[model samples]
Target: MGLLMFYEYLDKVEQLLEQKKDIELYNYLENMHAADIAEVLENLEVEDQTQVFGLLSDEKATDVLEQINSEDFSSLIKALTYEKKVTLLDLMSQDDIVDKLIELPESRQKEIIAFLDYEDAEDVKQLLVYEEDTAGGIMTTDFVSIKKDYSIYYAIETLRAIAPDAETIYYVYVTDDLDRLVGVISLRQLIISPPNRAVDTVMNENLITVNVNDDQEEVAKIVTKYGLLAVPVVDDSNVMLGIITVDDILDVIEEEATEDIFRFAGTNEDEIYENDDTLFERVRNSVTSRLPWLIITIFGGLLSATVLTSFQSTISANATLALFMPLLAGMGGNVGTQSSTITVRNIATHAIEGVGIFKTLIHEISVGIFVGIVCSLLVAVAAYFMHAEYHIAIIVGIAMWANMTTASAIGTIVPLVFKKIGVDPAVASAPFITTTIDLTGLTIYFSLATFMMANLPK
Candidate 1:
């Protein structure tokens, strides 16, 4: 439905709930896709959400539950009866089931695990053993695989039997008799080729796969770089374990973006709105991430103040130099942030690759020089108009030019430095770049002013 129609439907659903029209409400909600239904639930009161969820078919309930945010899912799971919990766990994919289980306390997770079927329970247990941000954590074992010695006919029969449970059938993995992943064959190739052809005869032997221990972000990079539909996850022994599908990679991208954005803003990565954390709890999370940066910026501001104080005599004589101090510093910071954001995004997207660090820095410096000259000229004119001192205008202009060039160079370099040191570049760049610009900009402004006052025409 169009957004307006969906809104209208929500309004009607609200009215039906108000009248306790359970049967009508259930039927209406049942017709919507799980994601759409989850959206509707998100808009409803918590009590109403529980009621509406209770009315959904077991299959639909599991789907809708997975579509919602984990915090909301936690609340929904808490509201469910023990029997319903068991049913949902049984119905969910192993990867998703493990995710939900991990969200619960150990006691609760154990209880839920106890209720699962033996195979499902074992799968969830194995999945939960992987770190949350690794390939093993994100992949699902529910993919079709065939032995290299198998004939195409045997593979087709196996796929036909397991198609309902398989997460993907587009590419079937070809493993050796030892269960080592050796190759892959597309379903399209399988259908066209003769049934008697050995799996090894048709399979592409050079397969792209991720180690189970690879970081989820790295997995996302591989998927994006290779334009893969699905990538296999294998153990150290080359045993095929699971596949991370394109849809899962999309989730990883979104999650990484959200995390990077939060880190840039100096906030904790997992502060979702649906979390029932108190105001203080949220503040604590934010403060823990932000305080150290603020402390460093505080020291930086003090250093800037000291630099300005050291040039008090020059400022006292010119008086107008102080006005441009803030402007120069602010502009430098803005330019630096721009460079940092662009460079960070380029790194994330793999647009700029394998270039020498010094070369990249030099390129950014050259760009900065071009941009700085243009901006410095504009600021010089503005400074001249704002004051009568020709020397002050020249001082401000030179400071702006120098500061911007330095800022841009630092901005580009800091992220690369962080990456080289194995720190997340996005999380470390913004505060450091801004502070460096503030300190350098102020020192450049005042020192230039002192020199100009002593040498220039009066």
Candidate 2:
């Protein structure tokens, strides 16, 4: 539902709760989506939140819990008794349960684990050992697989029995008796083949799989590249551990994109969009998130000021030189930002072509040359009309051309170097790139001005 409509419904729900209209409140929420219900619950007082939740059937309540944000999920769980918490946890999938457990304190994690059946607790424990950003961490052990020796008819029978709780039965995995993943057979392929044939004869032995430790971003890429419904996660020995669905991959894509966008804006911060957090908490987080970037920018501003101060004589001789400084620096920053943004995406998607770095550098610099020509012509014409100083106009044009080309080159090289050194290309950052190019921009403008001063139109 639209935000306005949800709020409108929430107002009525609140009025009903105020009047102790329990049945009416439940009936009002009955038809809403679980996500919409969760949103309304977030806006309610703790007592009302639990009261509303308690009205949901176990299945519906489990769906609501899945739909809520982790912070709200944790807060709601804290209000529950141990028995109630376990009842909800039991209804959750393996991945959802692991995710919820991660939000709790270690002691609380242990407390909740004590309530689980032995097999469920053991699976959650196993999943906890994987890094959160890796395939293993996000995978669920809810997939269905059968031994390669099973006949097609037998495989169909086995899948029928397991499909109820399995994550997906669209593409069933084929493992050996030892549980080593050997092949894959789609439901369509299995149904079309002779039911009396052995599954191995119909399965595709050539498979693509990810190791448990592979990054989640890599997992997303593989899934996208292959147009897969899901990808199997296996151990070093090729033993099937779990599977990552496309839905989970989509979450990974959203997370990585948001993180990169924040980095580009120079914040190195996260959690900027948790609207359900308290006003004070949000404000505090925003301040902390932006503080480090502000500090770095200050140092960068000082460095820029120091460079300008060193060119005191040039500025004194021609005060017009100071006016052109901002134009030169601004153009350089704009070009560098464009180049770096494209380069970072190329690095992330592994789409860097077979073209050599020198070829790539030349192409970017050529782009800079065209941009520089257009911008410098405008600046030269503006200088000539406003100040009527041929020497100043000429210097401005040359300075712009030089600074822009240098900015483009630096932008392309910096991220590539970061990638080579095991740093994320995203971390090269717009602030860092702009700061570096500002230093270059200033030095170029002043040096060209000094050269023209020494030799032109004395």
Each model's TM-score, in the order given? Answer: 0.93, 0.92
lDDT of 1 by residue, 106-205 (tens): 8877866787889878877888889989999998878889899889999899889987777789889999888899999999998988999898999999
Model 2 spans with C-alpha error above 4 angstroms = 19-21, 78-87, 271-284, 356-360
Top-scoring candidate (TM-score): 1
Residue 85 Cα positional deviation in candidate 1, in Å, after optimal superposition: 4.6
Global local distance difference test of model 1: 0.84
Off by over 4 Å in 1: 1-9, 43-46, 71-87, 356-359
Query: Clashing pairs in model 2?
Result: none
Alpha-carbon error at 203 in model 1, in Å?
Answer: 0.8
The residue pairs found clashing in candidate 1 are: none
